[model samples]
Target: MVFKELRIMRGPNMWSRDHHNIIAVKYIPEDIPALSAEQFHAVQEYFLLNFNDQQRSEQNTLSQFKWTIRLAALLQDKNFSHDLASPSPDILYGILQYKTEQGGVAALETAAQIITALVSAKEPVSFLNASLYIKEINLRNDFGPSTKIIVEAAQARNIPVQKGPAGYIILGQGENQQRISAARTAATSAIATNIACDKEDTKAFLESSHLPVPKGVLTEDLSHLQEIAESLGFPLVTKPLSGNHGRNVTCKIKTVEELIAGFS
Candidate 1:
């Protein structure tokens, strides 16, 4: 069968410091020819220089290495062929799924498809090096039905699943893409489950528990915002009711325009 190039892109979670898994593009052997030797060497040097069998202490470096190694291996094995009598062509579509945590279920599924494709095509595919990450699982927020689909799919195949801070990273991709704001829902779920929510909720929850909240209410109307501001104090904060990361959320609104923008 002919080798087909593919690319898939995704975003990251907001509240988490790690960038959400951003892009999972795929390339064939020929694609690498376009990359200068310097770029190739840089890739090689990074994996070779950092990391050992020891567990990682720093999250940023750890996640970066895991993705780099996995991507390089997948690309190297692009031409791996499978036999004719095996099964469906869908398996041939090898995916390099980007994730925000160490052990990515989607990335594993992608790898599994490649193996299945090879087996059906009569080609040999083997697991190279599998690693794990310690992922923080928050309770409360519902993943809708999609989470169930992903979990079930992984389990049905008996694919090994491990968790970690492997795949999380925010894309600095800037204004072109829609900013992720689902963090509030995620934070609520996390707060319910015992995972620490972001600064805003953390402050609110902590204050409600025993401390002091600035007596703020979530609102979109500037008039109401001003009322709340007057009630609370001069230097009060008006922020998005739902926001993740420190990206779009602002602090200490001194003007109506800033308050309006944040609330809107």
Candidate 2:
């Protein structure tokens, strides 16, 4: 088995930021026996038998194994392309998206390892070892470095810290319960946050308040993009009307061709 790629995606992505941290792995299962209906069922059974342990309930483990089998089946089906060439070789791919509270990357990696073990029928695979590794990783990442600092500070101040669903932390309790998300507090202005989220809106608001802002026009039309770029002069910036963290944003667009490509 050859792993083609392994990546850990963090922050806001296609998946829910509050709930999911995805670990994506692409591998070629050349060493594994040919994927057949019988082989698929055997792999599924093997996964159920070997992967269950004290770390997770049997039901949850079965659920995860089912999902892995589905992915494997999807990849095994030759009708659909996995973005490879038409005459592509057989490939096995899997993605594990774990809840931030459940261990995130650690859980994802363990799941991938389980799938690999089942597919290849590899021996010396210990669920106990995997469980312990996941536990260690969970302990290390349960409270991220920044979150740990905040948790410690809250503890020092005698604020009751309670873990909430999807990586949220609640400081204090009952009516006095204050939610803490990274540096954001319960009192953080929702209107301000929304305004800050939209780059064009933020620019407009700042300009209205006599603050300096980049001169840019927002348009979805590619034809209009060139016109707007020409009006603004060369070396302009192109970005999605509403986005964050520089997603789909291209800067220093100096020519019409560059603007067109940047917009696309």
Candidate 3:
């Protein structure tokens, strides 16, 4: 099988409006020829017998095989589902439009790999590794610790929650709506954001508050960086002045060479 392309639908799209967060994967079954119903059923039965450990269905349609593998993968570790699948006439054919909140290419890609594994089960594929891969995908796309807590807490109270842009969680609807992203809220001021974002300014503010902060210096040139390294000693960290989610951060430098590379 050949995977052609992947498209992330962030908002209202041709496939779905309600379920906007989706991964549209274009794939092709390589070396596949037109087949009779019996041939197709035989192939499908072979796959089901391979996964005899899991529940199987008799009917084998494009969507059924996809959903079976999808559910099987979901049970392997995390929750996964799709809104629908469609066929295309263009070069990029056989669209696997799967719904995913966090994973981009992972969900569809994993499905394709799982199908390949099932087909290769005759020679005994690495089913254990495949299951682990699915679990890893689930964990990879799961919400952060704090974010998950907030989401679960809201759900306990029967609030309507949806994923928001920029790693936020939206609760309720219309006038009663509220948004939370980690510790920040809609009422968080721009000033507070600035103080938190700029590492230099944040250190200064914390120091002024008589709080201990990590010893580091912000630098824009090689000379300043060298000065910081020499003064602060080895085993240092480097990062952009203002960034989030470890965007440009590099850590644990024990040598000048590594420090220079990290800064660069």
Candidate 4:
């Protein structure tokens, strides 16, 4: 089921299973400049908290977030605009939603367990990282379509939500089922009138085209082969006449063995 193009698609009939809502967003490095300091802070916290948990990729996640913050600061210093001449924003964002009752409970339990362990570790980095993870335990924004659904659901429940910027979706026929029939109709209307020729067919067509083409004989006889070869001149090029992309074309052939190889 889609709510305002945010697909909160149902899963299996079982009540235990979770549903997923998906949204697609495009990204380019240039959009960092438009983001306010608070927005960038939110982004930093988002990566530190949400992404690390989502994919269970904490080490790389921390590294990437640090790199991103550094890059954003660098861009601001350089006074460089993201897009050279275009009017579009430099960055894009998407939201996805997942409906998981058991998953949420499990996540909560895991958070508590990690908090206990973090205190035991007594490391600032470890404690900070664990705290971020705990903070993101309830975060549903990183997943694209989910964010839209959450906002809509909250609104439905009388919770006022300022909607995030709408995303631009570029779908192709390969993924969009609605375009299939139209694509098929267009393809049928643009059908090729001429059928492709096989080797024998092409040989006949080329011979008829008044080109210097060698005559082809049925495999049963050597007499016609020699006769045609003699007529065409001793040093002749032989090839499979119906091939494409230079598949079987042979040139500069003086020996009979090379001719046989070209034909066979």
Clashes of each: 26, 0, 0, 12
Which candidate model has the greater lDDT, 1 or 2? 2
> In candidate 1, how many Å is residue 171 off?
20
How high is each candidate's TM-score? 0.27, 0.37, 0.52, 0.24
User: Clashing residue pairs in candidate 3, if any?
Assistant: none
Error of 1 at 248 (Å): 2.1
Q: lDDT per residue, candidate 3, 1-264, as tens digits?
A: 445566765445575544444555554433333444554454456446546534334332343335433544343443444434346433333223333344445545555555554444433234465456656766766666666777667756666677778767787779999998765779989899889888899999999999999887766889777778889998998889987656677888998889999999
Model 1, which residues run further than 4 Å from truth?
Answer: 1-166, 169-205
Between candidates 2 and 4, which one is better according to TM-score?
A: 2
**1-264: candidate 4 lDDT, tens digit per residue:** 011121122322212223222222223534222434443344445436533423222332122223332222221221111211124554332222232322233332333243223323422233344434433543432324434444445435433232123422221224431211211222343322122335666556667878775554445444456666666666766655354334467887776777666666
Query: How are the candidates ranked when ordered by TM-score, highest leading?
Result: 3, 2, 1, 4
Q: Candidate 2 residues 73-172, lDDT tens each?
A: 2222211112221234554445554433345444544545666665556652465676566666566556665667887787667565657777588877
- 227 Cα displacement, candidate 1 (Å): 1.8
Off by over 4 Å in 2: 1-163, 166-184
Model 2, residue 47: displacement in angstroms? 29
Candidate 1 positional error at 28, Å: 25
Deviation from truth (RMSD, Å), model 3: 9.2
lDDT for each of the candidates?
A: 0.38, 0.57, 0.59, 0.36
| Poorest 10 consecutive residues by lDDT, candidate 4 | 75-84
> Is candidate 3 or 4 superior in TM-score?
3
